[model samples]
Target chain A: MRSTCLLLCASSSASGGGMEALRVFAAAVIVVGFGLLATTAVFSRLQRNRFVAALIAGGLPAVATGWAIGPGGLNVVDDSTVLLLRPLLVACLGWVGVIVGMQLRASLLATVPPLLWRWALTDSVLSAAIAGTGAAAVLSWWFLPGSFGIETALVPTTLVACAAMGWSPETRSMRVVLTPSTQQMAMLIQGASGIAAAVAVAVLGVAAQLIRLQPDGTPVLDLRTAVVDLALTAATAAALGVAARHLLGLARRKRGALLVVFLGTVAAAAGIAVDLGFSPLLLPLLCGVMIANFGRERLASFELFIMRAEHVVALLLGLLAGVLLTPRIGLPGTGLVVAILAARILVKPVLARRTLGPVTHGDANRSPLRFAPLRQSQLSYVLAVSVVLAYDAPLTRTVLTAIVFAGAASDAVPLILGFRRHREVAQERRSVAGAEA
Target chain B: MGERTDMRLLVLIARSEAAFDPLVTGLLDVGISGATVVESRGLAAVLRQDLPIFAGLAAFLPQTTGSRVVISLCGADRLEALRAYVAELPPGDRPLAIALPVDSFFGLEPTS
Candidate 1:
């Protein structure tokens, strides 16, 4: 009897080891899948078709891919695995924010004409507000029957609004002849104006996240707390940026070591943020912006480091987001969300064209002005998705669904408008030929 | 095209900013992987930086100060191909391309 009991224990231990090995294999597969998914989506944007760009850019495919492999579908990436990997999600987001920070240079803002600033602000802020407020009202009303309140509605509404905002006036596909000075100047003014607006509003959203009210009044003086939060976030970013910059500079000589250091920095930032109550994105973002602006060499090094790792991280986070969205928002609810996204798409471009009208005082026939098409790329999508994951509530998930759709649609907008214009021109030319006959 | 025995450096000064892009594409066509771009001012502008007296003459010049200089190192066999590519730059005032022999390059030494 004693020998038999000892033999049973040994068999159980062997089985346990096998289970552990299986877990390791699954985790590796998921990581690799995420990396490949993200890389594919990133490369897909290089193609000319805006629809394809939008589909991939929305990260919808990645999310769906993740869901297919998650508990909701195949039970591959179980709940425990996702929960364990939360820190990784934060790090991926932080990296995306860093790329965003790099895009918005201090010099770009400094050089922007005051007149152009007026229009860009209108396109970025006002349009976002209109979309957010309208969506918030309708959705909150719809979800009010459930366990939803005004406060609950605010986050999703704000996120969707923010995601759909930012008009990019740059029509990159259109050929511009520089003979006409007025139109050339108009095109140049509208060039980065939309992107600048998007950057400003995104930073504003970060500021919004920092300020929250508690019923107990334990967190007093909202203004003071916001200031403190901003300062802390800035300090964290600066320290990490400076440190990472040094690592990157050294990395130039030792490429392998550089990859290791970059990974360490990302992990460190995410770990620290999770320990504190702060969003992991804030520090890395501020760090990226500060470094990019201050040190040219640092910017170059940072880009090289980021260029290697960003897509992988984004893919990982996007995969996690797919798993996290287990509870479905339902068919009708999703439709309403899609409608809100559509409203934002409709309103923003019209507002953008109108707002910039003051800046563009020239005849369309004489000097055809092409305003930068409202472009929503990695920044808008990444920021909104990060918020959804950070908040991780039913309402936030609903908002995430909408934001991803809108994010994808934004990429396709330029193509959609261009195709329509081409059709219209063809029709007019046919009509002219008929009249001559 | 393959591993090189001798290395040479090609320095190109493009007259137009637009010409620089076509030149780089031309280099890539002939299989040059690495190059550096340095934005530079015209000789008059450089002289103005040295002595402010030439600053007044900026109004007279066409303000063609924006220029791109591209530098790339290539294997000896590829030098003729690069020269041919540079010579094919479009009909306008194009750009100037010069080649120099490199001796004992550090990290840049070809595997062959």
Candidate 2:
């Protein structure tokens, strides 16, 4: 009788905990829905302003809203809530991966300039080296110290480096004021950004698969296991891709069925990656590449449907980042953010000019679009969020914070610098008019 | 190409598909019932599709759906009312209209 009573008591406690968790999860969904709706309404009206649109595109407002309502601020979206929403977050990560990967159509990439690839490769290498060094130094000095080995240090290092590699492709504000020659340069920069995004994620995927963090936070580099996991992920992605293609092809006539198929495919892929300890970003990415290449024109509409939700996915990831943020990035974390900001602002532009200057026949060296390298890519935020989802450690959270702060600050650099030039040009035009009068 | 008549053929090219509903409603409000609407694709879209290199220019172009072409035949008095109604429509919804004298009429219903 006593043993039976104990079992009942334990079961009741478990049930109570589950119910409490459900309540928290439901409340979080409502808050997120409200935030998304509010952001959509405001952005719809304000998107005409290029700067505002850029911010919206970067998911900054969503991030800010998330931060305001999250544990760091209101303690509403707490740790337990985020833990429960992990699957949703994983699905979003997969969505981003697929979207980025679909742009990698072989034919489209064939037309891309060779110089752009060179620039992307060179930029990724250099940024990784610089950011990786800073990450190592900071991690060694303050965060990791003696307990964890170099493998552990390398995880956040890879993250920061990848985050620093790409420049923002949103050059609308710059293009409006650019010469035709400079505008072409902007296009080249934008093309390079697209390539760099793929490179960043690819690098992140390889690094993540190779490094396994032990239960006690000790990172172990297991080459054999990594290879096996990678092979499994690729195979799984290929199978899922083929299945999704067939499903999408069948459901083409019915929009409702098509949407359900797409959602189910993403969830399955994401759930598999999460369950098997695969990089969520990589599995769906490879799947998207398959869909893009093999599915061809039949899947074009499905790809478009997926692309349409890119912004919402980005916003959702931003919200996840905000809720997961610890807001306790220590001195080392602050240093990492400042170091990243400095490197992005100071080093990235010089490197870009030196490397890509010849491609534009030195036009890039003279144009305001030259400042484009200072802005961080929107993909950088996606990269940071993926790391948070995979790890959810204090170290990963700090990296996310650093990347977010650095990216926002870097995005502002070009705009602020251009503002002075714009003002001067306007004044010159006004003076000419006055002189004529 | 024919004798002067009271009928005018109004060919309107609306800027976007979204404007079609309001455009047709306004036409009805002005007492014109019969009209033909045809889907159209803009020149830029054609150029972008035909010339892959021009796809790069898409980023700079303002996003817009291909226009709609609307053709209607009505009496001269109804044409004047149509012009006034279109003028009151929002700038974005306002269609580019070209009215020609319907030199000859075949089968049509006449509203007093």
Worst 10 residues of 2 chain A by lDDT: A1-10
How much is the lDDT of residue A368 in candidate 1? 25
lDDT of 1 by residue, A146-165 (tens): 64444445545666665555
TM-score of chain B of each: 0.71, 0.78
For model 1 the local lDDT of residue A23 reads 62
Q: Give the alpha carbon lDDT tens digit for every residue of B1-112 in model 1.
A: 3334387777888755556677778777878878888886555332222111101111122223446788877777877776777677655335687888776566553522
**Who wins the lDDT comparison?**
2
Alpha-carbon RMSD, each predicted model: 13.3, 9.1
Best by TM-score: 2
For the candidates in turn, chain A alone yields TM-scores of 0.70, 0.87
**Candidate 2 displacement at residue A17 in angstroms:** 7.2
Q: Report, for every candidate in turn, its global Cα lDDT versus the true structure.
A: 0.53, 0.69
**Candidate 2 residue pairs in clash (backbone atoms < 3 Å):** none
Model 1 chain B, poorest ten-residue lDDT window?
B50-59
- Which candidate has the top score in DockQ? 2
Candidate 2, B1-112: lDDT as tens digits: 3344887888999866556778888888888888888887555343222111101212322333546898877778887787888888867578889988766766655431
